[model samples]
Target: MRYLAHSAHAQLGSLWLSCVGWVLTAMALGLIQWRVWLVSDRGVISSGVAWVGVWRACFNSHALVTPGFRVMHCRSMSLAETFTPPEIVAAQVLMLLSLVLGLCGNAGGVYALRNIYFRTQEDSPVRLAFFTTGVLCLSAAVMSLVPLLWNLISVVTNQTIEFPPEFNMPPAPDSQHVGCGIGVGMVGTVLMMVSGIIFCTYRFPVRSQRPGGSSSPAPSVSHSRGAAVNDNPAFESHEDL
Candidate 1:
């Protein structure tokens, strides 16, 4: 049980890193937009895409477009492998969390767009487009939950259990699963970052008024009327008269 738990934990960690890495890659790509404005280098665009793809693959399993090249290797069991129940639970939780992140991201993206429409009539097209793209990417991230769910089902059913002397229950090969996960994570991360950049660049920072400044006071109706009376001496002369 302890060995199973330990192995499961390691798998979870690996899964998480793969997803995060892909997302980061996507973010880096979105950041590329900023680079266009900030950097004047020649090869930045091509390099940025390459970097994004590489990182995306690194971070998430699903992003791996080609998994036929995975090398076969022997492995050993760890201490946590002994605790299978908790391990299964942990896997389910992680999978659920990923799905939630995707849904939340999409919802937030829509809200941001609505806010932009209501608050600012003059919004940049670039930002708006990116916001839309971000929502889609987040949706992809949510789709990555499929394999995790499958893994959970397998664990619950005790399908991985082995018997007798060679009771070592090794982790099943997960190349396809991991590849899909990485891809989804990358797409989601890219969209999210793009949305962020769009919001930041398009939305002008609200400046606060200083406590005491030389700026003119807001004109009030009463003040205006008082000034009118002052302009017309007849309106105020009754008291003096």
Candidate 2:
């Protein structure tokens, strides 16, 4: 039992490094917006497509076309513009938390794995490292999901905002569509969750006694001054009983 348990524990420690790698990958992907599209509600002639991402916003107009080509212009979104919308703000915060937590989780997992394989600390530190890794990875997954869902919801239920005639832009589109960014983010979320499960499962360190070691008492030794053979019994000294 001890051998198996110790072996499994060591294997798990090594396994967690992969979890950290996965979590880092997911978190990195989560930072990008793959597919968020907004359609203009304006008439077809005045209608346009707008693409929003975590870092910037882009738009293409169907109104102005030369022969067969269309023009597209992209602009970096300001913090105020990116954060003004309630849903956007919520998503921004959640995704940020996910990234931060993922970083923390990776750090903790690496620390723990090192401690386990290298026997850096006696016992308590490694346990604490595992616990921290689990908590952080779990937190990162949860945080990632919130923003992914929120931003997606915002895309589907979004209403067209009205603009004055002076601005000359069409009505906000009724059928807003999600972009590839959101899809990629969703995928990242799933990966993050998988990593979280691994971290959580191995959070508790498995302790085992050293091989060939036992706490049981030693066998007793008996001493006698008598001969073993009956023929030699006569020679045995029994005080002339």
Q: Could you estimate the TM-score for every candidate?
A: 0.27, 0.65
Candidate that scores best on TM-score: 2
Model 2, stretches more than 4 Å misplaced?
Answer: 1-35, 38-48, 60-71, 160-170, 203-241
Looking at candidate 2, the ten consecutive residues that score lowest on lDDT are 1-10
Stretches of candidate 1 exceeding 4 Å from the true structure: 1-91, 119-178, 200-202, 205-241
Model 1 Cα shift for residue 226 (angstroms): 26
Worst 10 residues of 1 by lDDT: 51-60
lDDT of 1 by residue, 55-105 (tens): 111111222223443321112223245533333344334434554554455
lDDT of each: 0.36, 0.57
